[model samples]
Target chain A: MIRWLLLLMLAAGPALAVGDPADQLPNPAQEERARVIGRELRCMVCQNQSIEDSDADLARDLRRIVREQVAQGKPDEAVLTFVHERYGDFVLLKPPFKMATALLWGMPAIALLGGALLIRGMRRRQRVAPGPQELTQAERDRLAQLSGRPRE
Target chain B: MSEAAPNPEAAAWRRRALLLAPLAAAGLGGAGFYAMLRGLGTGDYDPRGVPSALIGKAPPDFSLPPLEGTGLPGLSAADLRTGKPMLVNFFASWCVPCVIEHPQLMRLAREGVAIMGIAYKDKPVDSLGFLKQRGTPYARLGVDQPGRVAIDWGLYGVPETYLLDKGGIIRWRMAGPVTEEILAQQVTPLLRRYA
Candidate 1:
């Protein structure tokens, strides 16, 4: 009986999370598309979570807007642009490549190139003087002379 | 790719530079952080401030019904483009920040500034009671019961204020309570610049 109760709870849990069934599109394909778009939108309230993942009221409203746009047969870009026009680039989880975002987009490539150069420099450094060379016989004799110790 | 052995002086210089790199970086970062903290203390920096996209653009189309029992006229987007700059404020009965901002709004209205109010996501009865208690400063009022109109305006939080130019373009926006200092420093300057 307890197992049955637990199973019942597990089934009901996701239904509650799906939230306000009226917001979902009737077409399954459209619903999936709406969800994909939702994942790209930032929740303005939470500042971190995507509208798809956040339970904030603003997130819900954005999700509903995405679904409505999808149901209207709007392309993904058009729907995204509709939101972008209203909320600006901050709403996009992946910021668009523009003069304003050039630095943000270029940083990973810059870091990668820096890392490659660093590794090559280290490799060249390692190869040039393959670690500390064994002291020459003259150097060893000189070291012994300086320290006043007999060479073994 | 020099075949000769590395110069000892050059290698030593590189080693010294590598050692000092982190210290220099830390010093620069610490100075920047200290400046940011000082700005925060002086109310010059707002870490959570999000620049509003609606600035320099007209507001989204909306026409909200007035709250019942208020006897105030409803507000709409058409009412905004009347060749007069005005303030649009979204507040709620339950928002404590709205209460704090109310006095400034009242002061502005006393000086004959056209102020429009939207009761955001609050019940009509609660809004009416709130207005009754505080005395409405609004020249025109609307109730956004379902908050759809708020979403159209890209409103994420309540107690937000917008200043519109004579052309009905949004000139400035303040997201939190409009305290006395903010009224004197920022909003007053923005109003003149747009005017």
Candidate 2:
């Protein structure tokens, strides 16, 4: 049981150390706010990862900035706007809906609608397709003659 | 009784029309793929080329102390409004690209361009040593020990250089090392234009 407990603790080790950087503010509430904000801000160094999730030096700097802003009593929107103004729209993990990002945000839905239309068109075509017609006596006779066989 | 079958040509046309569904889908898919590739090629997909929001805006004011005992003057935002365009270079002793660009900075300094340096997130002693070894190319050198001033400048990383006009508005920013080709083609033209 002790060995199993030790293994569990070891498994949780990295998770505990993940976002607990030395730069975290001493105020727990402020730190929490910073974390919330940081989670929404992309790490400029690691584009796909949020600053809260990235361990890159740049990310740490960003996190510190966020914490400092929060500690200074800045509102969340103001803090976000500050970084956005400096880094452009790329620093936000969730890009705002705008003219430039319309295609990025709408492409999946557009593709889905296109796919649905295609499938519906295919199904409708299949439904409207004419069934195989029974061979007429004359066509049967012609086939028999061509094949050199006796007609039924 | 004789019966006629459907017209062969009309049926062929209908079949061809039915093929349009998949063809349109294939076209849409191809377009999406092409867009994704283009986005990856030129858009914010590459963060290095991400545009600085400070391009047209005046830089925030800052006053940083010179590196301890270097005898260099400290840099301030007010110094940039000297009625002549200048360059502000952010570098660190540890950054390899900064070493690569040091000689170019020296050449620019030699050409009478007033350049200010920020030793970003570096120790004062290391910065002093670096300037001593590589030769000083800056009119003023400031040490950003905790990097608060750097964050205020929205610096992405070390080895970033910004060209400010006489009014202290940032005109152009280069993110990485200053190669000779870049200096000639990009920097020199801008300097001449601003001059």
Candidate 3:
């Protein structure tokens, strides 16, 4: 019975270990920062690949730098700024609010405003247009009588 | 003598239609957003699952400058057919995955696997600097700076390795990091079989 239990436990050990690789890593705080930084930074070697997805040598190096900076207690903005200094703005998908990135930053607001204006315009037209309800009581009664209802 | 009231159901329906216009717009907008995500190639895909054109076909034929520029000779697909199987790795100095896989690559080189390296989309100077620091495991090295050669081989990203047979046809291709287990199970058997 003990032998069977040992075998079962041994088999289950590796299965448990495979669950989440991140859990085995040393620091969760640093790892989380690294992950956040990685998603922001574009992989220089692969076109369209973020650091998180890239397996390139440079991606690994950048990931190491992120972890190191985080472990050293660097602020998120500071770490990002440091990397940006070396890599430039192209490295970030969500570019900073700046002259060159004005379009990207302002797009959502512009869309919202435009939509609001369009809906407002539609509502105004609907309000102004006379419908069947706009008719006077006498007109409604006349129409109803014409349509064979009891005349008032 | 009583006034005729409006058709209550019809009036309610008109109100409901007004309410539903925005809902319909929202549904259409949502579908459009979903299509944009997929159509723009931004959707998620496992890099490892991406198929390589060179997997079953003959690798591209080309020559490159040696590490030392020793002028010994350049490597080509023909070099793969020398009675022993070979491994060709496409890497760049700038790729992080390539760095992670470097130790494994170095071990493979030490094991007399007869590896060929391709420098993809990198400057010659950078490539040389990388090999210098990393220690060259590549029996032969090729430079593909224009990236035309890599595209021809259907390479999506860096750190892709191919195992070619004695006939220069690719037997297997690995798109991501090659672990020790992959080398032991998949690569070793092929190498031994070809040998």
Best-performing candidate as measured by DockQ = 1
Error of 1 at A9 (Å): 16
State candidate 3's TM-score: 0.42
| Per-residue lDDT over B62-114 for candidate 1, one digit per residue giving the tens place of the 0 to 100 score | 89998779789999999998787889999999999999989998998887778
Candidate 3 residue-wise lDDT, A1-152, digit = tens: 99999999999765642213442237876787778877898776674877666666556656666777788888989888866654457667677788978988899999999999999997986666655558799888989988998866
Candidate 1 structure quality by residue, lDDT tens digits, A22-99:
777889999999999988999988889889877787788889888988988999999999888878889999999999
Per-residue CA lDDT of model 2 for B54-142, tens digit only, reads: 89889888999988777888998888888888999999999999999999999999999999999999988888889999999999988
The lDDT values for all models are 0.87, 0.86, 0.73
Candidate 2 regions with alpha-carbon error over 4 angstroms? A1-22, A133-152, B1-47, B68-70
Which model, 1 or 3, shows the larger lDDT? 1
Over A1-152, each residue of candidate 2 has an lDDT whose tens digit, in order, gives 99999999999866853765578899999999999999999887767889988877778878888898899999999999988888878898889999999999999999999999999997987766667779999999999999998768
Kindly report the interface RMSD of candidate 3, rounded to 1 decimal. Answer: 12.4
- Chain B TM, per prediction: 0.84, 0.77, 0.69
Which residue ranges in model 1 land beyond 4 Å of their true spot? Answer: A1-18, A123-152, B1-23, B41-43
